[model samples]
Target: MFAGDQNGLQGDPRLKAISEAIRVVPHFPKPGIMFQDITTLLLDHKAFKDAVDIFVDRYRDMDISVVAGVEARGFMFGPSIALAIGAKFVPLRKPRKLPGEVISEAYVLEYGTDCLEMHVGAVQPGERALVIDDLVATGGTLCAAIRLLERVGAQVVECACVVGLREVKGQHRLNGKPLYILVEPRQLTNCSAPSVTIITRRDQLSYYSQDSEN
Candidate 1:
């Protein structure tokens, strides 16, 4: 997602596609659980490029020297974004994920807790950075990442996400340093009806239709 004060930026089509690509699955990994899935968006070239373009346009003029993405899914769009902005990509990995000399920090997740590690010498002092992810819940992971960056003397310029739960207090954890998301969870209610469906390539358009119909 692209960060901005207003939603009517130059990338509305991209935002719409991203909003449509997101699927909500209930009871994932356990009962009483709902998961926000972005795989659909990632798999679609137009949508993925749209997402990348939005971020690129948002930070094109900003002096961002590095783009640090959290582990796993963050790697999907992070490096592309870094390349788009002419910035180096940095990874904040799970414990023991990185090989060589590393730095680590522990953080709480909405479900439990985990730790992140980075190569100690990766980020230089006074570097400018942006953090991106597909989704944010409690903001714990992002905060931990920001702390890690600060510890290494890098200045975090902003935080961006594709989907955000506005009802939650996640943004507060960032200390109001310009949090941005293409779609807020609150907006889900605005759809005629919202449903999650697993669609094959042949049924992709139908899936989007159902999303709007629901």
Candidate 2:
């Protein structure tokens, strides 16, 4: 069983709002997987707003020059944080998704190898960037994003995610870059297939399956 570590964001009402908004789906895309679905969270206006507000409050004072968001879900939070922090938002896309000259970085996933790309000139050298994603599992995608930014000479300030699977130890792959997350996974039982308790940013509580190995 995994112990709970709330990252000290516990007890904040905003954490409760965000926690309540998420929908957990079990055995999604595969068996023994519990997917933390943010689409449900997006439906709640107040909860979504609170999620953005939490990120904005953190980055507003940091002189961030770019917000590099991973393909889809990161799109939800990256633009808001970029706008709030007076920075530009850049999308790190999947293979061949963008037009014009591009740069690519390949990384390992839980299943296989994949690549991420960005427009060649989207970010200038020496810019400070923050990488955003919906969650961090094995950290493969975020590592690719960081490499993409560094290839352009952009300094990665940090990586942010809404949720993290503690067992995966994705944070270790960050090359010492800081990772900020709203929730962390805690195992609820001693069974081989355990359910998980999620400790929200404000230490608000919720539960989901631990089936997903990512």
Candidate 3:
């Protein structure tokens, strides 16, 4: 999707629509956090469809066999992309969320430690996989998803997220997995409202302070 790179994406019209559709809800889930709410984006059928279609068009010919979505928000984009690309959808869920026997991998989040679980036989060795998530704040969740797939012997071709946010300096690299992010938000602070420097993807909304204030 990012054929020419970030600079090229800066000019791409598809991403612009997605970006506009994403609303920055100030102090959501807590104070001082400006959350990028994707639910609104999901509601805009044209924008939502464009977001999914962009991903489908990119991976359609990439020989992707498995689409592993990090639980919750990843579920939103993952299944759509998987169906379009002719890949099976695998959910990497929160602890105890999966009914069957599962394997787990732990990772650190901006707040605390958490883990992701996948069904034992959900994926096969050597199958090409793509991990999708709604946001990549610290990259912990996505990394865990990638490791979980790798542990099961599946080859993860890349990790894809709706947002590519670089808050910490050079902290989001897990085994150098390639990340394909659809939108990198342009931080818009109100200057009048309190601002924080962190954003977490809670599937719903977590807060960070990059906003377009009126």
Candidate 4:
């Protein structure tokens, strides 16, 4: 069991199962990028179930009323957790994808800005929400999703992901909201293979900023 300053995950066998199931593709969509592919993980039923079970076990007791999944991948884990925890599943979609009075939030990416949209009446004031995503790279997408939920008065309980890239430093932009993740950043090496590391709490978000000042 890995421990950190915050709430820790104990004796979780699902972590290893998930890590082994991911397939890493080299230079996908660009050069010098290792893409962590979950589709391969999805193909393995036991691995996929283990991944969802880890999240469901953690959030099942929490009073999360809505599970908001980001555009594509989040749709996979969000619905399962939502159903397990007895919450409604809401889709945080891409631009112009949702119809009928949608609310949108724009966030900065390493290259530029992109927008995420949600239906206007999807969340009500004071409702509790949990944001789900496959991975946290630069955090722009998740940040945008959080803003969209908060803009309409929903309280975002936390952001959850299967993997987090510490080198990318997107966790810094989460605005102090707790991010629960199964795999830590250090475990993912530069090699062209998918991997997973032990879980840990992200206590600070200004790691990149502090490095840049030096």
Best-fitting candidate, scored by lDDT = 3
lDDT per residue (tens digit) for residues 27-115 in model 3: 55666666667888999999999889878888999999999998788999999999999999999998989997999998775557788
Models ranked on TM-score: 3, 2, 4, 1
Which ten contiguous residues of candidate 2 have the minimum total lDDT?
Answer: 198-207
* Candidate 3 TM-score to native: 0.87
lDDT of 1 at 87: 96
Off by over 4 Å in 1: 1-5, 8-11, 186-214
Model 1 lDDT tens row, 1-214: 3332354564555666776776655534333234567787778888888878888888888999989998777788899989988999999988888999998988754346678899988999999989987776557778888888989999999988877655454679985667767775322443333333221111111121223432
Which 10 residues in a row give candidate 1 its minimum summed lDDT? 199-208
lDDT of 2 by residue, 50-87 (tens): 88888888888888999999988899899998988899
> Which has the higher TM-score value, candidate number 1 or candidate number 4?
4
Give the winner by lDDT: 1 or 2. 2
Each candidate structure's TM-score, on Cα atoms with residue i matched to residue i, is 0.81, 0.84, 0.87, 0.83
> Residue 90: error of model 2 in Å?
0.2
Query: After superposition, which runs of candidate 3 have C-alpha atoms over 4 Å from their true positions?
Result: 1-4, 7-10, 169-171, 186-188, 194-197, 203-214
Q: Give the TM-score of candidate 2.
A: 0.84
Cα lDDT listed for each candidate: 0.71, 0.75, 0.76, 0.73
Instruction: State the number of backbone clashes in model 4.
Output: 0
Native-structure RMSD, model 1 = 7.4
Candidate 3: residue 156 Cα off by (Å): 0.7
